[model samples]
Target: MIILKCQYLFNKILSKFFNIYTKLSFSQTGEDLIIQFIIGSLQLKKVTYLDVGTNHPFNMNNTFLMYLNGMNGVCVEPNPKLFNQIKRNRRRDKCLNVGVGINNEKTSTYYMMENSLLSTFSEEEANRMEKNGEAKILKSIPMELININDLIKFNFTTCPDVISLDAEGVDVEILNEFDFNTYRPKIFCIETISYSTNLTGVKSEEIINLMSKNGYKIFADTYVNTIFIEENLFN
Candidate 1:
């Protein structure tokens, strides 16, 4: 049964990539396009986003295509360079050069890594990655820390349609800080693992459980990211 399901999904994904990859591939693993396909099938329109840890405007960004598709939203990045890039490139979207979380203070140290994607605010995670030789810490810079919900409310006139989160090891922390009932993003594309792969890993179940309790269903798993859809949206 597992093999049959895998084969079915493989065929479906293959068909999707060949059909609309060019139009919908702003995300690293084509998550934007895959979500677009599902949203289209559901007859949904006017998609907006709250892109947390949006590293770049295009490279590995999950919300760039949404911006190009006439959807306006906010892009939050702790790195000043990347935030400026997003501001310059995606002029229509609100760009914030700050980290999203409930810090005790207004600012926190953001560890810049050799691989920019691995850069994070968690010192422990950074140290672990550096020890593992997975990443090298270049420097630590003070970044403004803002409450996630407050940022969303200030930027968005209405609730966001989607929320794509990729904040290194702090992804779950950011998710935990969000008021799920108030924001209630219809779709979520969240990085659930420290490593990237095509196969789902063990660490994702905790995130899945959290989202499940929030009335969301696991829609897809791209190993690095786990996509969730609000349960009520399908009704």
Candidate 2:
């Protein structure tokens, strides 16, 4: 009777321990998994990020988990509403209410959509959405626009460790403006898909070529986002 009672007690303790462990564990997404791989491979406890097109502070955000882990950096979102939301939720991070592109324009017309994540600076994307009736315009805002490289120089004291780029349809333009030699992010989480969900409109090959020239290799591609890491870093 005593042995059976002890076994029951041990089982209860084991069950309680697992429950606690489960509560502490979080599965964010494929982005989080890739981020974890970078951190683990680099043996880094904290990292910095430049999150462009930060639609929501949490939902679909690649840097949200990093932020929770005491990592802070610039979050650029052109949408006023979403920017405000990011400001409220991410007090530790620097929030910018501006669009980033290849040229430093003083003001640019931002296409704000009902689902703010669908917002883009690309006229082609906006027109496509309108024609398909996929997304409705919430409003148009004349937002400040800066070159990606210039914005990084102005915001961060040093280059961010990781750059999470998700600029809807203009991601390539942003990359073109980025001076990879001057500011080489250890890891890049970029959305290669342009207008379609089926990867039909993705410029993945171009991005891969660009990164390959810079000595970075494709670390992982989760369909929606592709992760690249500097080849020298892993060694």
Candidate 3:
């Protein structure tokens, strides 16, 4: 814990002093640094983000770096355990223990995978991964499942500046349901591939086309996740 604090402090000092020239990524593949670079170029002093299916508070989290920079947003996690961890680490953010879904259901079956990060609400995905020996289902529980637009409308006065979504198999569903016309998030970092253990996951053409149609261009593709920037903002 002490080491983490020291590292956090060291990282903050470097970022504040040297700007984005110095960065420490807590994302799966340095996505946060890329996000920070883009946000740095913006005319804004602070930005808001919504992390859907946000598994961790800091470790391997997409928005933790921004939190350390004194920015706050909302984090949605269906797993109670993970939600507790996020609430503890990110006291500044509004952390909710709920799942993001496309339907009007109040709750969904939350599949807790053996590898917690791969957990999902999709039975098909859970079964597929378990069959492939990638990860087994540890447990299943009913959790609150809110619609994509409802999430934003309830949480933010306007669209968040960034939305980091990784709802396992439901990433595209949530993204598709988002009200792009009403709310325009500046950036979106979404898990854009089917999960796999043997490196055969297929890329999500649906997500790519959806974002493109919404006027957001692909800024970077980290395989695990794809980062998109608003066309107007990118220009």
Candidate 4:
């Protein structure tokens, strides 16, 4: 019976792969490139993704591709307003109104701006803006903090296939707190907003070095985002 079950699952996976390969072959050039890279690099029919700071769940997310390919995962957003937006957009996946950082605690007084895109938890960046005389602040709800390990203890049966981080100014801090040796996700997609804000932004080289220390290699570096894959996984 165990062998029969394994054979059934193997046949199902082979069928799915053939279908996906056919669809991919006929897809548009740009879409085909992304699908091929993700499917080929990760070697999975369905992926588990974690989108940190998934504000508003815009249409441009790479996670959307996973969803289209019959994958499911969690979306974490700290801001209440933005979290609601994400919840509305990603009704199929688990959406959490929490922040990913070094610890699990309730934080208060997160800064909100009229332009929601500028909202962040970094008071230092807010203060720098005040110095530059362009400061705009509004009171907002606090986000519950949870580390990556905490998530593993909760819902994840296995490490996520991909983890995309877009936590505004705190991307570096979140990456630093990740124990890559333990939860080595297959791919990491991080936003690089260094040019947009006056925050103490991390340089591209700094990001490369941090990922390298954790046994990851840079796969792609677009102007707005950088992609990293586990070195051992790709080999």
Report every candidate's CA lDDT: 0.81, 0.78, 0.88, 0.67
Tens-digit lDDT track of model 2 for 127-167: 78878887887777787888888888899888889888888
Error of 1 at 53 (Å): 0.8
Q: Name the lDDT of candidate 4.
A: 0.67
* TM-score of model number 4: 0.76
lDDT for model 3 comes to 0.88
Lowest-sum lDDT 10-residue window in model 4: 20-29
The residue ranges of model 2 lying beyond 4 angstroms of the native Cα positions read: 1-29, 197-203
TM-score of each: 0.86, 0.85, 0.94, 0.76
- In candidate 3, how many Å is residue 195 off? 1.4
- Summarize candidate 3's per-residue lDDT along 1-235 as a digit string, tens digits: 3566688788777777877434567899999988988888785666999999889888889999888878899999988998999998889999999998776778889999988899998899999889978898999998888898999999998789999999898887777788889988898998898877777899999999999998999999999899999999755
Question: Model 4 clash pairs?
Answer: none
Q: How does residue 176 of candidate 3 score in lDDT?
A: 74
Task: Please state every model's RMSD to the true fold in angstroms.
Answer: 7.6, 7.7, 2.0, 8.5
Q: How many clashing residue pairs, candidate 2?
A: 0
